[model samples]
Structure formats: structure tokens, C-alpha cells
Target: MKHIRMILINGPKRVGKTTNANLVADMIGRSLPDGCRAHRINMADRLKTLTNSIYNVRTPDGQIAPPDYLEAIKDQPLEIFGGASFRQALIYVSEVVIKPRHGKTVFGKWFLDTVNQVCKPGDVVITADTGFASEIVPIINQVGGDNALLVRIHGMDASFDGDSRSYVHWKHVLTFKDDTNAPFRIGDASVRPDVLARGGFREIDVTNELGFPERSAQAVLDYAARANWLVRPTEVDLELAKGPTL
Candidate 1:
């Protein structure tokens, strides 16, 4: 089997996760071989489509019906469901039932089974999103171990970025209150942490290369300059023709 490689870009919100992911994708694309190509897959988009509005759902007749909607999912048994007592049982149900299902699309059985629907071997898939790394990383290690590259982007400077990169602004309902008792909150929220204790990967500080004095120093440029080492050579015989190593 071809050694499949997946570059997982992970970081907290407002940390330029998406922008930096695109930059990495561009660098990889520019340097890739003919048959080898790089593509960026935003798991956030796929996730929203997979999980229908599980929280704050409304009845067709216009009645608030979050709990009624969660009634169906409450049956699925998730042990982690009991740890944190959420203000809204409905939201909790969605957490345990809906979000965990993303693993099927992320890096395991369902991912391999349906990968051809979007990707193939020799394809470098750069993915970005927020979920439980502890749970997701294990599955990735189990299935794609050597083929996966987990990238943790850290130390954000959103001020100079001149834009709102946080998903809280876009995906969140802003004024969401699951019920009268539930606190008004942002989104069906989560954070992507930098520590992946088990996965062997790269940690890039997206901000370290940016800003006034260091304008020319960029993470993408640095990676692009050295990426050739990471890419498999398209031809070995041609290289062997030159010389042999000691």
C-alpha cells in the first residue's frame, strides 16, 4: 500500500488555523510531483453538514424544541456524557451523540471506506477543525499511524490579522440559550489544544514569523523552502544514476 500522508492542522480559535492551513496547502501544491497532489479539507464544513442543527432546533410550527430533537439522540450511550453536567441536557445530548460521530469521517474505518469519495493514495490531505484530539488522535494512530502528520499551530496574534478568524462569530447563534435556565452562549463550542501527547508531529507558531520587524519571515516560506526533503522523489533510478551513498 502507498504510504498515505495526512497533515492535520490544529489550533485554538482566532489562531489563523484556516489561513495557515491554506498556506501550507499552497506550499505543498507548488512542490508536489505529477501524480502526487495536495488538497485542504475543512472538517468544520463537513461537520456542520453531517450534524443537522442538533441544538436550538425549531419545530415547523415555530415552537422551541431543542429537547424534543435530542430525544432521538439521548438513547446512544456515551460514557463521557456523564462527566460534565451541561446547563442544557439537549446540548449535552448533541455533544455525546452528534460530535463524536465525526471520527467516522476523520481518520478511521468510515474514513478509509469512504475516502475515495474525496481522496486517494499519493494525495496529501491537509485538514483543520476542533474536536477531542485525545479521542480522534488515537483512531488516526491506529489506522494511519505512519501516514499522519499532526500539526499544532500555536501563539496567535489576531490583532494584525485584520479579521475575525474565530468560528464563534460566524457559526455561533450569538444569543443562544438552550432553555430559560441555560446561559446565553456562543456556539456549540470546543477548542483544539496543541498537546497531542501520543502523536509524533510538528508544532508551528503561526505568529512567530509575522508582524512588523519580521515581515519577510513566514511559516509558509520556511516550510516551502524545506518541503522538498519531506516529499518522496518522483524517480529513484535517475537519482541512483548520479552516485551511490557510502
Candidate 2:
């Protein structure tokens, strides 16, 4: 079998990336290669959860906790005075945590080391979050090395009647042609470049169910089996041959 390592599950919030990834991971029995793992990049929420767990506890030193107790609890400490809880959990093979560091930090060598340490040969590292906003492709390029696969899941509801009485924003619904190169706006600024750079393999039409649940999950599995990312050369190779774009 081809060494299929690294899979990215990208999508809008609450669109079932996590749920689907879990289902798929279970379905394939041996879906995950040895040393391979799955994770959710909810750094803020995760940090809060971790902080809350050991938040107000008095240290063994019999003194009050330190000021940076929160930072000391992350899965991986990106900074000097980082946490150790996350680092400990990540020592195992099946641990899901959030991704810290934005921008170049996302592709930093330390970040790669953490992943490489947890990930082994034939491993499939998965990220089920809105990480598609920035360096999606470059991140994938960096992670997958040469034989990795990247898949993005899109959660959309297309049943807008454009009624003035509708509760949801009917005008924001995507149209037929709008699927291609649609502008993703975040607040006043446009985060389109980040999303587009990572791009998507196949856009799942989740309009009917509005929550891919199992279909989207199965689609990702099936797509990985036959997706171009699995066969395409390394991201650097593609960039060298096609020109540096993302």
C-alpha cells in the first residue's frame, strides 16, 4: 500500500469535521497507521479547559500557582515558559489537542518536530478545524512531505428562500458559480487568500443535511483513497514545477 500520511479535515465551524473524522477513524478499523493520530486545533478552548483543570491548584511547593499556569498546560509549548501538560499528553500515540502558533509558527521546525515525534511511518495526521484560512496548502505541504493527502470539508446550507422573514442571512448563501473562487470574508477584512491558498480537494455539497455527519466523513475517506494529493509530488515539487504560488 502507498504510504498515506497526513490528512487535513478543513471546514466551517460545527460542520462535522470532528464527528466525521472520528467515525471514519473507527470505520477503517486500521484506518490510522501506527504512530498516526488525529487532533482538533481548538487552542483557545483547549487551553481554557486545561487551565481550568489545574487552574487554582496549589503547587507541590506549598505556594500559590504561578502567573503563567495557563501557558504551562498546553500540549506543546511554543514559547520558552510554556506548559507541560500538553507535552505529556502528546507523548502518547492517540492524543488530540489544539494547534498553537499562527503564521510562520504554524510551519516552524519545532511544530514539525512535535508532529514528527507523535507521527510515525504511514501515519495519517488529521486536523479538523478552520485551519484552511491560512497556509492550508503550505501547512499540508510541510506536513505530508511527499506522500500525504489533504482534504477540506465544507459545511453549507443552500436552502435559502431569500424571504425577508427568514432568520438566517439568505443573501450570504452561495450560488452555483459562487462555489469557484468564492470570497471568504471575516469581519471587515477578507481572509480569502489564506483559505484559497490551502484550497480544497472536493467540496462536499452538504446543503440537504447541512451536516455531512457520515456522508462527509465517508467522502473524506474515499477521497483520500483516490485523491490527487495522495499521488501528487511533494508540495515543494509542485511549487518548483508550477511556480511558487501558495
Winning candidate number (TM-score): 1
**Cα lDDT, all candidates:** 0.41, 0.37
- lDDT tens per residue, model 2, 21-86: 555444432344344444333212333334334434345776544423443344344343245443
Residue by residue across 1-246, what tens digits does model 1's lDDT show? 224566656555445555556555655665566777777765444223233243334567875543224333434543334532222333343355543543212322233433445666666767665333432333343333345545555553433132212222211211222331224322222212322233344333345233321211134335434544245332223222222211
lDDT of 2 at 230: 32
- State TM-scores per candidate: 0.48, 0.42
Give the C-alpha lDDT of model 2.
Answer: 0.37
What would the C-alpha RMSD of candidate 2 be, to one decimal place? 15.1
Q: Any runs in candidate 2 off by more than 4 Å, and if so which? A: 1-4, 29-104, 107-111, 133-138, 141-146, 156-212, 227-246
The number of clashing residue pairs in model 2 is: 4
Q: How does candidate 1 score on lDDT?
A: 0.41
